[model samples]
Target: METMRVIDKIRQLIPPLSPGYHKGQAGRVCVIGGSDEYTGAPYFSSFSALKLGADMAFVVCQPTAAVAIKSYTPGIN
Candidate 1:
């Protein structure tokens, strides 16, 4: 199926997970977006990067959105 092919490609791109790797060795991601009306977008974007094996994720957003984004998770920068 098409989905299976996509999954296979993704697996090929991701390096093997290993304890020998240090932080930031996996990857780093930066998401830029957020506003008074749409704060969750950036938060989810950055969070998704982390969930997908990124070691660090940073978000750039308005001050108001920054507060909400930070509240969502301390794991993100």
Candidate 2:
């Protein structure tokens, strides 16, 4: 299956919360794919996870990538 189809299926599987539900009760995800030469990958992954409704997301990367990713945005760290 394609990526979009997979994402759609996941969305379908996730049930909506009740009216009184609070934050951080849904899901948390960490994007762990960055290296000295690849900081944007983690940024994109983390942002995409957030866009997909994850309550929290984090980017784990090598030192060089961490520096660049931090420079990209404080939120990325």
Candidate 3:
């Protein structure tokens, strides 16, 4: 029940998608956490944002992590 309430609250906060809305008008998400030893978290964070209707997602990470994250998908910048 608590989860349902949280979901409802989030729903209320998100604007309804409209045909007239341009790309990125909905939302943009940036995830800033990654290291050579741990790149999955940041990649997942950015990917989740895109999956959840964000128009764009960016990941900031260590150079070594950047390559791994980039290999996951071209969707994230």
Report lDDT (CA) for all predictions.
0.87, 0.78, 0.87
RMSD to native for every prediction?
Answer: 1.6, 3.7, 1.8
Per-residue error for 53 in candidate 1, Å, reads: 1.2
Q: Local error of candidate 2 at 38, Å?
A: 1.0
Q: Which tens-of-lDDT digit does each residue in 9-52 have in candidate 3?
A: 99999999898988889999889999888989998888888889
Give model 2 RMSD, 1 decimal.
3.7
Residues 1-77 of candidate 2: C-alpha lDDT, one tens digit per residue: 69999999988999786767666666778788888887888888877877877777777777778888778766445
**lDDT score for candidate 1 against the true structure:** 0.87
Superior by TM-score: candidate 1 or candidate 3: 1
Clashes of each: 0, 0, 0
Which parts of model 1 are misplaced by more than 4 Å? 74-77
TM-score of each: 0.85, 0.68, 0.83
User: Number of the top candidate by TM-score?
Assistant: 1
- 23: Cα error in model 1, Å: 1.2
Q: Give the clashing residue pairs of candidate 1, or none.
A: none
Lowest lDDT block of 10, candidate 1:
68-77
User: Candidate 2: TM-score?
Assistant: 0.68
